[model samples]
Target chain A: MLDTLDLKLLEEVADLHGLPQGAYNIRKNGQAADRKTTANIDIITKKDKPGIDIVVKPGTKEESVHIPVILSQSIGDLVYNTFEIGAYADVLIVAGCGIHNPSSEKAQHDGIHEFFVRKGARMKYIEKHYGEGEGTGQRILNPKTIIEVEEDGIVEIEMIQIKGVDHTVRDTEVRLQKNARLIVSERLLTNLEQTAISNITVELLGDESTAQIISRSVAQDNSHQDFHLNMYGYSKCRGHIQCDSIIMDQAHVTSSPMISALNTDAQLIHEAAIGKIASEQLIKLMSMGLTEDEAEAAILKGFLK
Target chain B: MLDTLDLKLLEEVADLHGLPQGAYNIRKNGQAADRKTTANIDIITKKDKPGIDIVVKPGTKEESVHIPVILSQSIGDLVYNTFEIGAYADVLIVAGCGIHNPSSEKAQHDGIHEFFVRKGARMKYIEKHYGEGEGTGQRILNPKTIIEVEEDGIVEIEMIQIKGVDHTVRDTEVRLQKNARLIVSERLLTNLEQTAISNITVELLGDESTAQIISRSVAQDNSHQDFHLNMYGYSKCRGHIQCDSIIMDQAHVTSSPMISALNTDAQLIHEAAIGKIASEQLIKLMSMGLTEDEAEAAILKGFLK
Candidate 1:
């Protein structure tokens, strides 16, 4: 029972053209709009809390879950979701949130997600934050993610925030065990008077564990952005952190990538860069019969691609 | 006249196979070993210092000068050199230093270079630093460069320090006027127990002034490095600063790139990144019939290229 606006928001945030095939949950305007569960996956709503717990069977394969949220009215919604992947199982989780407020009241959403991957398990998580409306109301979204990987487990997370959110602060923390691996990539953009702050921390605490964090962002007009990342190696592990940004017009960007190695065999490194578009690149594009503005737009599109 | 070792040192540092044409001066073992000059360029010994002053006439073109320093013995040497480029002229300047210490005594050299580019003039400066020898003594080099560009002037500088310097520090400063441009590119590598520190600063104080600073460095084994760069835009100007570093083994690297904009129309950005070699890149190279060590070497070479 979703209208055209709800369908469009789902497509924009989670790449959902219609109702998902596998287990899924859809919440709109602070209430559950649709839900479905499969035999291998169970999405049980918490009796004591305002959220759901997803449990996947052992050795489950080719199974996925979609927990997408949308808002068409101004409201304050806060939810907590937990995920547990069984041993040797592999799964995909798509949890995206979008807000379309057309009222004068402010619209805000806070989602806190916690995940646990069992021994030898693997998971791919994708979460997107988006906002759109022509109202005077302010759209705000705050997302928190915590993950723990057991021995020989692997986890990959992709977090993206493209446009329209007035304010956001993304917080993430991860811990890896023996022979575990973790990779997190975040891409974001901020324009107008919007501001975004991201804090990510990862710890490799077991032998041969590895983690990598990569972030790319752009700030345009009068926007502002800050990225703070930290990686710690406490055993015979390896870790790397990288952050890059582009600043345009009167925008401002600040990046800090910190690494600490406590063990003798631990190897860690970090790098960050923030600058505007290269003039030579713009000129090269303009030479191909494109206007200055068009060339600039094309370059920015490519940079964020 | 110079000996075989002196010629080899020249070739290693300044790319001079023999006596350089046009204008040139060679210093070896704390004394002048060769000298030459052309009609438009004059190399005159300083009366108050142990150095030389190079002067280029107005509208001069296709003219170049070489001032290469070589130290084959363990000795302490210090020199100060200055250059004056006339208005509407364009020229190239090569100043490189190499030290080969084979004695038990420590070898050190400190060079301070100052340049004044007149109105409408342009200059290209190339400098390379290198050290070698199987000696118990340490090799140390400290170079300082200060430049001031007048209206419509341009200055380009390339500084390189490859290997074998046990300890070194480089310092550079620049100031640009209206329509003036300054570009500085630096490349360095440190290994073993060696340590290197670099400090570079630039100020854009006029309308339409521009400055760009690019740095690439690699630290291997137990080596350490520190790179500090600063750029300030005081008027309606543009400036950019970028630093990239690769860390290997038990080595450590720290980079700080800071920028400040004081005017409403001023635009400035700074970026710094530090990391190890990508495993995928190494695997790709190894698939082409290369060993792991060879692939690592090839990647490092390409990175610094």
Candidate 2:
């Protein structure tokens, strides 16, 4: 029982082009719908748990799944989703959340997502959050993500929130075991007095574990943002963090990156930069018959990409 | 008459390998000494001024001068020096100050230097400051530099302070005329609870003026450093500021760069990064049979250079 707006939002956030025949998919709006089960994946919910459990069978071939949550108005309860991958499985998950509030009341979504990757499993997860409305309603989101990687497991996550949301606070935590790897990329843009804060923590708990975190953000027209990335290295591990931001029109941004090592063999490094667009970049684009504003927008798009 | 210590200090600061017979030179301890005059240069002291006046004749060929100051012990008076360059002149000035105190008392040096560059003139100025002693005495330096560049003028300044300074506060200001350009490069190293603060301001007052400021610093063993660079663009000008710092062993560093454009055609940008030495650099160096400490020191030296 989906409407036109729901279909459009699902397409926007989750890239749901057509109905699936064999692949697993989950559509949730306060309750689950169109839940599928296949030979390689099993999606089930328990009576005592609040969210569903996804089990990818061991030694499964490369596969994909989509889970999109949408809300067209204010909701009364929170949303919780969990995913568990088995050993030697290779899978990709495309998931996101979108809220549309076209009224005078405030609408919010607090999403909690947890993922567990077993030995030698590899996973790629992408999530995008957005809001759009012309009314005076406030669209807000507070998302918390927890990830655990077993021995020799690999996980890569990409999160993007580009426009329309009034406020957001994203919290992410990840732990890596022996020979495990984690990579996270975040892109955000805030304008018109909107605010955002991102707190990310990564722990390299075993030998030869590696992690990298990269963030790109833009603050325009009195918007504000703060980013904190903390990485801890226990054994002979490696970690790196990087933050880049562009500030315009009295907007403010602060980035603090901290790396602490408990052993001499651990190597960690970080770098941060905050400034406006470079003149040479703009001039080079304008030389190709683009206006200044168009050149700036193109450069921003490339940067986020 | 100059003593042996004075001669050694001059050699260390100004690189005075041999005495020049015709070049203009001004050596000051508490007062000016070894003042010389040439055909294209005249050194004169004014009655109402606390410093000397250096006049370079217009359309002169390339020339070189050395103005080095030394303070072997504590001094109660402030040192002031000024230079005035005529139109279409080209010159290079090597200037520095050194303080040596081997007692329990604190030693201080406050030097003020001003330069007036005429239209179409070009200049390259280099200054090196240092302090050395074995006692519990503190070495403090407060230096102020002011520069005015006329139309089509060019000025480049390089300042270095490597070691042995306990405390220092450096202030520099510059004003640029039409089509003028200014460039400044600073290198510093602090260790063992030392502290340093650098404040710089640049004003582009005419059309097509350009400026660049770059600073590289190192803090080790509980040292502290702060850098502030402010650039104001009032016309169709361009400016960029960059700061990079390395911190180790509980040291702290902060960098703040501000660019204010008052015109539509003006473009400005800034970047700052603070962190420890990169592991790749250290590993690359150590792979060449160097020790870890040696590799770190070599990296620091290369960064300062």
Candidate 3:
């Protein structure tokens, strides 16, 4: 039972525009609905399988496919989903998970997604996790994402979590083949006693492979955040990791980025900074007639953006 | 007796071009020589005084004075020095300590310098510490610098230690008053089995005060380095701390920068980065017919410069 607010929240987090009348859509971990024949995408369900699979065939002319799995305010069971993207398919996938727990008897969701990118294929994946509830129940989400990029394949991922989750543990692991490339950009904001931990590991196994990982986070009001990224270079490759965070009001943040190389030609680097808001930034903004609180809010918005 | 090599090393560190015939000069922990009337600087030595004092009177017109205290190959004692700059004085002091130990016994130099800058004065100080020896004797240097910037005063300090020291611990502390400004730039390079630790603290006690601290370091082979900087803001002030390091071949480096504020208008920020050389940089240099080692050396030179 989904209402207009539920749909709007799902659309905001999952990039859903209109109703699922033409393209393929899945609702509440259910079967595919309103499937299009000429869309080059197929959704199938096993007779006794617990999760559904959406496959994008090779050489698909479609630019992207949007599939959002949402949970409503009622207490419900956890959902599991998987995606299989074919080789040589140049497309984008807009996928995310949104939970609205107003009645709140402790709602939870655990999504495990694995991606396979074939040779010479390029994929852009964007995922945003969000939660909202007025009830006293806890909202928890634990996500595990595994990605593999074949030779000459390129994959770019952007993950964002702005608010509302009480606790989350995100784990991502990636492997790159010869000449493959991977880029991951993550942005998170935790406020009011929330907790977030991210563990990411990348391995450059192929010659001339490259990887870049960037994380930006903000913690306020007794929140806690920990981020760890490790990159291993086995062959002649390049890698760079950057972590930036802002801590305010008894909040605690820790960032540890490590780079290890077994090859002589491997080049790797990492940069991390954790501090409070700069006074000059606030002064410059407040000089334009805004209050101190307004200035801080504006700076935080710009930093997250 | 100072030979050609000794003179060259002193000149390299203190920028001494010619003998001081009119200005004060000190060598080997000795008293000031070549005292002149045109210079308003006085060197005072008292009985049982552990360190010598050089006082610069007000309205001193001399642009710069070079004072280098050298230590030969013998197992010697410590050297201490102090500086007192009067009000309304605008001058530069280029001072350094170089130890050439070619013996079997351990050699060390502990130089402690304190500076008192009166109100409305401007001073620029540059200091370099270096050591070289072929024997198994340890070459160690521990230098402590204390500075005070009065109201409307400005002080800029640059410290450099490139090579040859087996171990070093550099400690610096500064206090700034109303409208006062202080800037400190430190560059260090540790190779082989050497180690270095730098601890710096600054307190902004007056409104409109500012301070900036920057550190650049490189560690290679089995060397280790640690840097810590803390800034406390008691009024409306601005401060920034930056640390950049390059680690290679079993070298370990750690950087911690903390900023605390007691007032509402204090703004502070810090940034730190540690990593090895980038592959693209090496590739770009090698494409121009340079070898890997040559590219790395060039990059290191440019970074240190």
Candidate 4:
């Protein structure tokens, strides 16, 4: 829900900008980063197509310079719908990846990043995962991202992933320079699927900078949710994180939120929590005449309370 | 921090079994349930009073039936240690008057509540406004709790409150069945004055039920922390909770955890995390290169390319 819709609001912001490649230009001029180029090799990116079907490889020679990057991916149906995040690209909205219908997802999962990369743009990316079919089995989508931010640049990424029958493997990378800032928020709701692994990396190669990460999740039934957030802080840098999870029934949730401050004055704090519901507490409420939904609502509300 | 070795373990499991009220028992031939008496508006029976300076009141009254009760007061510089789940009579922890500290905190911020409530006992109570201390003032601690469960049954309650400059408030209630369960977890890290309105109500209306709650806290930079938790459940039930908090740069934190369930099949989960570090993200690790903490370790070992 939005409070108000101001169409020209982006133009008012000094750093406001947007991806220039319209859908048509994106389809025609945007091609995958040149493939064939290899870097420190890791299996996750080994297929070399850079995980893209079209065999374009990363250009030879590392960009060496730190450039702000934001990763974006969406999983579910609803592919053709348009998404808008102010012109500055601070908010990333992702939709469209068939995760619920196993048969449809087998075809392929497509990601759109070439448009921004080709423009040499630096901005935040918002990723959203939603479902269209009734029940958890009809929709599923999985996507990964990579982002690099330059000095004094800022990248804010917000991802909301709701699991369907299909799972998602999200891997995002960001390299920041001196004084660069990055803020990432990942929210996940998992019901179906064996697991959801979110792998994120941020290199603080920069000095006196800041990075913030926050995650909230709900794991129910037999679902498994794992999150790995690691931030390496330089001297005089400030990094902070908060990770919270709610587990139900046989559901299991694991969170590893860590901060490594190599330099003095690198104030950093990391925290994680996992646990199940209280039954006797619920019965006491019921005995008080509250209905089942009321009880669940009350108990569940306390997670936020 | 625990007062004794046994208190250490008790802090870890108080949520599963009711905190023990050692030697605080009613004379076997003293009074019957209907014959119990009270002195304060708040009710406490002969069974709940120990050899203490102050008592809240006496007698236990059910909405429909009456039960036995007890009361006791904690003196100055007294770090009332932890209590075993199976070593004492069913009890309630309450803070009725006010508490004060000299060095770390000032007055104008005092709260009250019973530290431990017995299992298989119906309990109810409330606390007033709570806050921070002033120059040369004192710090206050007021927390109240109740427990009800069968032999070996358990209940635990944890709270944090910071309201005004002169005082604070905390209230709790719990009830258990022959073998019911309950647990409480509270964490608060803040500096500003805070008032807490807390409650915990449970009914052991069943056999073999349980409840538990845990509180974790870290405060720095002159901030105040406040928290409150409410728990209630029934027979053969089980409950667990964990709350973690960290404060920095004169920041403040206030929290309240509530648990309520109905049927014997009820199972609940609650977790609260308050911190300044996003430990599960790779940004911190990439920033420092060291990967020893849980979040960093997961990224270095489990989060591949």
- Cα deviation of B111, candidate 1, in Å: 5.2
- The DockQ score of candidate 1 comes to 0.08
Q: What's each prediction's TM-score?
A: 0.61, 0.63, 0.62, 0.38
The collision pairs in model 3 are A279-B267
For candidate 2, the TM-score of chain A alone versus the native chain A is 0.95
CAPRI rating of model 1: incorrect
The prediction achieving the highest TM-score against the true structure is: 2
The sequence of per-residue lDDT tens digits that candidate 1 reaches over residues A100-132 is 989888899999999989999999999998999
Q: Over the stretch A24-43, how does candidate 3's per-residue lDDT look in tens digits?
A: 44455232433442367776
DockQ of each: 0.08, 0.05, 0.08, 0.03
| Candidate 2's iRMSD | 6.9
Where in model 1 is the C-alpha error above 4 Å? A1-57, A61-84, A96-116, A132-156, A169-187, A197-220, A225-305, B1-57, B60-84, B99-119, B132-137, B142-154, B169-187, B197-221, B224-305
- Candidate number that wins on TM-score, 2 or 3: 2
Model 1 reproduced share of reference interface contacts: 0.07
Compose the digit string of candidate 1's lDDT tens values, residues B106-189.
899899999999999999999999898878889999999999999999999999999989899999999999999999999999
The value of fnat for model 2 is 0.00
The number of the candidate with the highest lDDT is: 1
Question: What range of 10 consecutive residues in model 1 chain B has the weakest lDDT sum?
Answer: B256-265
Clashing pairs in 2: none
Candidate 2 per-residue lDDT over residues A153-172, each given as its tens digit: 99999999888788999999
> Could you tell me which 10 consecutive residues in candidate 2 chain B have the lowest summed lDDT?
B20-29
Instruction: Name model 2 segments beyond 4 Å from true.
Output: A1-3, A16-95, A104-125, A136-155, A166-182, A188-304, B17-69, B74-95, B108-123, B142-153, B167-179, B190-305
Tens digit of lDDT per residue, candidate 4, span B156-273? 4434332222333445565555564555554333344432233344443565565666666544445444544434343335555555555444444444444443332435444555
